[model samples]
Target: MNAAVLALLLCLASAATYATAAVAQERLARREATAEGGNRSLLRTGAWWASAGLNAAAALLHAAALRYGPLTLVQPLGALTLVAAVPMGARAAGRRVASGEWRGTLLTLAGLGLLLLPASGPAPEETLSFSQVLVVAAASALAIGVLASRRAARSGLRHAAASGLASAVASALTQTVAVSAGRGGELLSARVIGVALLVLTFAMGGLLLSQTAYQGGLGAPLAVVNIVNPLAAAAIGIALLGERLQGGPAGVALAAAGALAAARGVLLLTRTAAQGAAPLPQARARDRSDLVGVKPAPAPESATVS
Candidate 1:
């Protein structure tokens, strides 16, 4: 089998695992209040640990995918996590999959397909220079800082986008580390250490933001993450890594359109999930004494009493 095919499969599997983890983690976030207890209780839960394990596995697969595929190709495939999550989430919530959900899922998949079809070729494996590394670190810190600042006031969409971008930066750093490793560079080198620190900061920040983003339900936040992570990584790949698509302007246009379509699907799915998660209106309890202003039966008097 070709390495590229294997890489694509690995990405798909990673997406599946990630989808499961997202569902599990979202449930944990809903069950345990992070602000009140700082996720201590949540950390102890089996579900939390299970999700963590799945995510770890997915990360390994994602790294492997990056090793064999271009960033633009592999990253966008992560959106499948959102597609997989909808049905899984529906099952967990004891709801049937709606038509709109299916439509959104199909659109997302089709867009992903279009995006993949025109990829010119695998990107050349390139290592970041010292200057590039510094730039990435500085940019990552600033972006994450800006995103973190809004966490207290922002809605779920913003939180998700922030976390997704953080994760993307981390992904880009990871790719650089991989390139270094592939070129026989020492892992303990200064360059590796600097990048590793940036990766750790962004990754942890993204994780926490994602947990808080659950207030709006899994679909919205997960969709944002799916959309943002790839786009961010692809941008970094093009700008920093000198990656390019083969088909020139036309290819770029198609890719952009596909991305927009996928985004639309994600938005639709988010809205659908939000609607599903909404609680049914409850019946108000009536006070026992009022009885809707109806008078109670008069007390019985002695028999034959006037």
Candidate 2:
């Protein structure tokens, strides 16, 4: 088969794997949230480890796709994870897919397609120097620290954003290591080893952050991570790696519109998720009564208790 076809197949497989892994992780997060003590060791959870394994498999598939396809092709296809995740998550939760979730997912996907489609040619082949790597690492750490701070209100969304930034930085470092290795540079050199170590550190950090994000719900948090990952990676490519967007002024305009659309979609998804997560009025009243040491009023005879 041709390289493009192979790449397409690999990308699809990767997207499916990613979707499944997301669902598993989100379920595990929910379990951990509701479990007593809330301090259950992730290492003791079989599903948590299983989800991590699936993520590793998906990464391998994605890397293989890049081998046979250009970034312009492979990167946009990664957005399919969000597309697949919505329905998969609904199915996992035994609920119907909501209309707003579908709309938000589609909008996010369209915007990502537009945002990634402007790179008309291959990016420059380059590797980050040790100093450049340090700078990038510091910047990513600061961003993640702020977003994942305890003061953040939308804990899930903030954690998801932090995860996205961490994953993006890790991708950049991985690219550096890949380029260096591909060019027959010294793999065991101090610089290369240090870069490799940073890659692992960020990758693991992102995984933990994403697990936390999933505790809120699937659609909105996953959308945030998926949306931020590529945009941040593209920004890194443009600013630090000598990459350029195509079509000059027109491309810039298109990318800006895409970014706006994606942001709006994320907002819609976040609102929808929040609405779904709100407590029922009856439940809220009952909880309030319980708080004051009063019993809730009895329900009507015909009313369902649940």
Candidate 3:
């Protein structure tokens, strides 16, 4: 097979692995409490570790895909993780996949394909210098700090959005590191070490935030991550890596439209999140009418996007 075909297959596999990891991590988060060390306990859980392993595998495959394909082609395919997650999540929960979900998945994939189809071609290899890497790192750090400050104690969307943004910057940093590594320079060099540290920081932050996002709900958090990761990575590629997308102004317009369509599809899928998917609200007042000593009522339920 040609390199292009191989790259496509790798991208798909990476997406599938990422989907599996997301499902596993989200389930872990949904069932666990935050007081259990704010996602740190996940390190001890067998399921969480297995999911992390899958994520590691996916990252390796993603890097390989990048080696053979343009950023525009590879990053857009990452959106497929969301498409894959819906069915997998439904099946795991012993629920039937909704028809609207199927439609949404198709729409998301179709729009992503349209957005990326014109971007066909192999990307030229480029290595970033230490200064460039430092700049990227500083920018990502600033974004993460801002997101962290804005996160509320009870808002799942805030947590998830923060996580998604962190993950997006991490993705870009990963690309930069990968490109630098491909140059086969001294591994212990300051440049490589600096970039690697940034990658680790954002990646871990993203992972923690993503798990927290499950506290808010499944589909919405996942949707935000899926949307932001690729867009951020692609933007970095265009801005820093000097990769040119096709069709110039027209391509930009098409990408914007396609992004909107994809976001809509994600919204539709959010409607399919399991009943009571979000975190429970604060407990309510006890009912005085109970014969036995009144017990506080449970918090109200959360609804997925309607």
lDDT of 2 at 122: 46
Clashing pairs in 2: none
**RMSD in order of candidates:** 10.4, 6.1, 7.3
Candidate 3 lands at a TM-score of: 0.80
Clashes in model 1: which pairs? none
What are the per-residue Cα lDDT tens digits for candidate 1 across 89-142?
Answer: 656554566777887787776776667655635634886776887787688667
Tally clashes: model 1. Answer: 0
Model 3 lDDT per residue over 180-257, tens place: 666776566787788778777877788777877776545666776776676777777778777777888888888888
Q: Model 3 RMSD to the real structure?
A: 7.3
**TM-score for each predicted model, relative to the true structure:** 0.82, 0.84, 0.80
Model 3 residue 116 CA deviation (Å) reads: 1.4
lDDT for model 1 comes to 0.73
Error (Å) of candidate 2 at residue 44 is 0.9
Residue 133 shift from truth in candidate 1, angstroms: 2.3
User: Which window of 10 residues has the lowest lDDT sum in candidate 2?
Assistant: 284-293
- Scored by lDDT, model 2 comes in at 0.78
Superposing every Cα of model 2 onto the true structure, what RMSD results? 6.1
